[model samples]
Target: MYSDDELRPVSALQHFMFCPRRAALIYLEGLWSENRFTAEGRLLHRRVHDARRGEKRPGVRVARGLEIRSYRHGLVGKADVVEFHSSSPGQSPQVTIVEYKRGRPKPALDEPFHVQLCAQALCLEEMLGRGVSDGAIFFGRANRRVEVPLDTALREKTLAAIAALHELIGAGRTPAARYQARCRRCSLLHLCLPKALRPRATAARYLALATQPPAPDDA
Candidate 1:
């Protein structure tokens, strides 16, 4: 179990999964830059979280901007929305965490989002002492929600990601950048400078040259 001081933001898991160097730059080096995508995402979240305090309707209760944390995963963040549905009186409610996104879902790049939802479910489970088997992601662009199952695979991946995030933060050293297709979309592209730093030669050869001690000058 991690202490409160040791916990990192749950959102960092998505960043880390999308790009390790991007995570390090933002979480470790405290760097951030706003782009169109990020701005839209931020606005969407703000709108979701701005909903009035929790409300109950018939069989369901809706909460907005609910703060959550998990000692097991060493993560903390606020949920955009969480809905609880109670089937009958005097029974535990089923929890459904809803995350809002700005763009349409992209299956190829949805792993990070899945990991994020799973992490949030884990936090809810720990806090409520109940199983949270499902969640949803509401895409603003599509105006639809995609249901996600909190299965063993997703849980395992979420745990592994948390561990990796802790390790990366503890290392206290930024990783060297490697250019990739996704770098174009990264808001930290200017700060990361992957293209400028990426090796023209083989990666191993570049590392050797970079780490090798300079030759002593002869008189």
Candidate 2:
């Protein structure tokens, strides 16, 4: 169990899954640089996150910007939305987490997103003292939801991520950058400079070697 001060944001798991260096860059170094992708995502979620309201539709209740946390996992964050589906008048409502994304569904590249959703589900389960069986990721581009199961495997993975996140934040040391295909889409690409600061050399060495011309006699 973790105290309020020790709890970390659930979003860190997604960043950590994407790249440890990127997580460190944001959470450790306090650096950020927004690009088109992040700006669009921010805009897409602005309406949902800014409002804390709920609506009812027959057997379901939709909550927007619901705050959640899990002391057991030391995780804290808000779900974009959570739906409570009542089966009967007195039966417990099924909790379902719905996270908003900026783009269309790309299952191949949605592992991090899934993990983040799973974390939220775990938080809800702990907070509400009920089992959270499933959740969904709503893609704004397609205006559709991709369902995700909060099975044991995903739960285990999310717990692992939470533990690792606490370890990362506790150490107070940022991981080094390593270039990857996804880095191109990261908003902090400019600040991280994964290519320039990758292992085996420093940014100065990379820049000096890349910029300096070959010697006249070495041709």
TM-score of each: 0.89, 0.89
lDDT of 2 by residue, 1-219 (tens): 899999888888989998888888889889776666677888878887777578888988999888899899888998999999988767898888999999999878898999999999888989898899979999998999889988889888887888888888899998877888987677776566667776677868778655654333222
Residue 186, model 2: lDDT of 79
What CA RMSD would you report for each candidate? Answer: 8.3, 6.2
lDDT of 1 by residue, 168-191 (tens): 999988899998999878877666
Which parts of model 2 have CA positions greater than 4 angstroms off?
A: 50-52, 199-219
lDDT, candidate 1, equals: 0.87
Clashes of each: 0, 0
Deviation (Å) of 22 in candidate 2: 0.5
Error of 1 at 15 (Å): 0.4
